[model samples]
Target: MAEKIRLKVKCHACGYVMEGTSKYGKGNYHPEGLDFQFTAVGKLVDKAGNSRVKGEVTILCPNCETRNRFDI
Candidate 1:
């Protein structure tokens, strides 16, 4: 099963708020955040079955339309 994570981003240049979602596993995608495109791959799993995700996401400012790089 894939886990769905919701994200909210604020534009640094114009201060626009965007909401989006990223899904883990199952190769399914639903565009939630309107201002950014994020792609995360690989997983870090613990002994207890818990996992930590690491990925790079880019934030697109609506006003300025600038792409900002971030790690999550």
Candidate 2:
């Protein structure tokens, strides 16, 4: 059985809160609360021709439509 972890994030612009759950090994992560969207920004290419996304992410807040950026 995999472990379940609780996740929470706060909006820096409006003080809104969001919650979610993720499985340790299953990689089934889902967020619940105000409607929001996230996009992975920036990319890095390795010498092996493999591309990996950066840890930085841009989140659009549904409450105020403010775009918040953070490094995860």
Candidate 3:
């Protein structure tokens, strides 16, 4: 069974925090490449099958109204 995890993210620029659910990232194989959507919570897999969450996450800071990128 697949387990759902909660990803708690915080914005360094404005100290805004967001908590959401996440899952293993999956995409459709296309002629050009794999296609996926930008999700608040999902893992990214490389060609090697190694999967991991995106190291850098961009979110809109509610406090500052600025888009900030943060490292998890």
Q: Would you estimate the TM-scores of all the predictions? A: 0.65, 0.42, 0.43
Better of 1 and 3 by TM-score: 1
Pairs of residues clashing in candidate 1:
19-33, 20-32, 20-33
Candidate 1 TM-score to native: 0.65
Candidate 1 off by > 4 Å:
33-35
Ranking by TM-score: 1, 3, 2
Report residue 1 deviation for candidate 1 (angstroms).
1.2
lDDT tens readout by residue for model 3, 1-72? 233434466767767676554444344211212121233355678999966655444556667776765555
Q: Write the per-residue lDDT of candidate 2 for residues 1-72, one digit (tens) a residue.
A: 444434367779898775654333333334444333333445568999965444444567768877776664
**Candidate 3 pairs with clashing backbones:** none
Residue-level lDDT for 69 in candidate 2? 67
Ranking by lDDT: 1, 2, 3
lDDT of each: 0.69, 0.54, 0.50
